[model samples]
Target: MRFFILILLFCCTFKGFSGDFSGTLNGAFTVHILLGTQEKAFNFGVSIFGTSTYKSTSVEGGININISPFFQKYGVYQGNFAGSMEFFGLIGYGKNANLLGSNVGLTRHTAFYDYTKTHNFFYGAGLVAVLNQATGNLKKFQNKQGGLILRFSDKQNSVAFNMVNDVNARPFSKSGTDKGNTARALISYTTIKNDELFGVGIGLDMFTPEADYGVAPHSHINSEEDTRLVLVNTKPYDDLFHLNLFSSFVYQNDDISFDGRFGVDNYKLGALVQNIIHDNFGLYPRFSWPVTQKGRFYSLLDFNVPFNTNFNE
Candidate 1:
């Protein structure tokens, strides 16, 4: 992992200094001092980020290090190919247990590409691989994922579709084999008036947990007993689904410009009229006021209230 990161860093720096290079390098150091009722704490952090672009290709790399009770570090690198393809990688390591109560190390890599002829339509597919290890317990998880995206836009209308799936498993485990999978699909369409002042949009999102299998340690079971915890296979939308319809409008004059969006979902409709709000129905209005040449005040309002509770049959 260290070697890979160094290689990417070298490439980024070499490219930045190469012929006719356009790039930026940034660095920051931060110090934090906290005073509490019982104890005081002090910590510092440093980060270096850089980006380089040669014609249509670009490379970005960054690293962050924090010196606290426990040392923490993270690094990320991404490269774009001719404005149509992308490659990305990230690594993180920490000495202290994270929120999950385990010392974690993570590595991830992803690659994707988009193809378009007239610039009005696009299609792409991507692959992802990840490794997550709990250094405290020597437990590791490997995830393989893939996704597809399609988009089309014209003067008055735009449409988009996306699908993704993930499969996670325990590799080289002595206790027992465990695996789980999930998938999601989404589609959206929007159309605007000829004047481009008002627009309406609709979208649907579907997600499901495909399968799950748990592992049991040998210490928790007898030698003669099976070590598998549980197995489950579920259908799409058995977990959650959402259908949304919304409208947006923009009004502008010489002095000020105003724009906002309001939307409702099937779950929201069921909640207000039928009193059958599903766990998935939480939509909020978003509005913003920007400071214009003649105005000095700016404000914005956007919020959502999400709930997840099972209804009694």
Candidate 2:
């Protein structure tokens, strides 16, 4: 992890010194320490996320260290309509779901062209690498996969499609018996309201049972297909207080799947308090209420405090 971080830092430093660079950095760093309830039990965790843009490049790294040691790092390089193309890389390291079995590592690399100048379409291909350490009854697994990404967006609507297949791979389940590939399609639409937006979206995700592909090997439950619908409102407020609203419906083969940290779906509301305390500090709070299912409906009230720093040439 440290080696990879150093490599990213070196890229920034080397590029800055190689040319007459003029770049600006702007973004945020958030520290989240919160306590809540789930499944009728108390829970607490802490995490930190930092995301910033340096000119045409954007980098983000985040980790959760309180309950689970989950880490994600990503970088994107945007390009103009020239010989250069947009590139992206993402890496994730963590334990599998249920905190059992073995550790898992994931890496993805993609390069695409930006066609918004002519039309609202972008197409690309990517490679995925999965590494799972031996644990429980499962053997060590290593696999290399490839996929295609197709996206289209216009003023009021957007759609994305992804299909992945294993080129050469090993079994990904603990029993070494499961296999399959995956595909997903998501479509969404939004209407402009002043500077804010209101949107509705639907997603369909499918995993063919014998797919040798190792996407999410840790959480590899026997999922035939999953679908979801969501409604969203962005920047619903015009004052110093910032707010957003979301409501979702999840349809899954598991028969008992829903949204949130817990399994209960609700009208989710979140707020941000910023700028009054300091230029780079803010607090965020979120709440949810149950609407469809009953059982011990959970209510959580936790806050996040963030501080930001930027460096540019």
Winning model by TM-score: 2
Write out the backbone clash pairs for model 1.
none
Q: Please estimate how well model 2 matches the true structure, expressed as its whole-model Cα lDDT.
A: 0.24
Per candidate, the number of residue pairs that clash is 0, 6
Kindly list the per-residue Cα lDDT of model 1 for residues 196-251, writing each as its tens digit.
22222332221122233232222211112222222232332222222223343333
How many clashing pairs in candidate 2? 6
lDDT of 2 by residue, 1-313 (tens): 3432532353345344434322222222323322323212111222222222333333323222222111210001211111101111222221111110000111111101111222222122222222222222111222223344333334323333333333443332332311221222333332223322233344332211232233222221111222222112122110111111222222111111112222221221110111121224332111111122222333222233323233432
List where candidate 1 sits over 4 angstroms from the true fold: 1-11, 14-18, 24-50, 59-144, 148-163, 167-181, 184-207, 210-313
Model 2 off-target regions past 4 Å? 1-134, 138-144, 155-158, 169-313
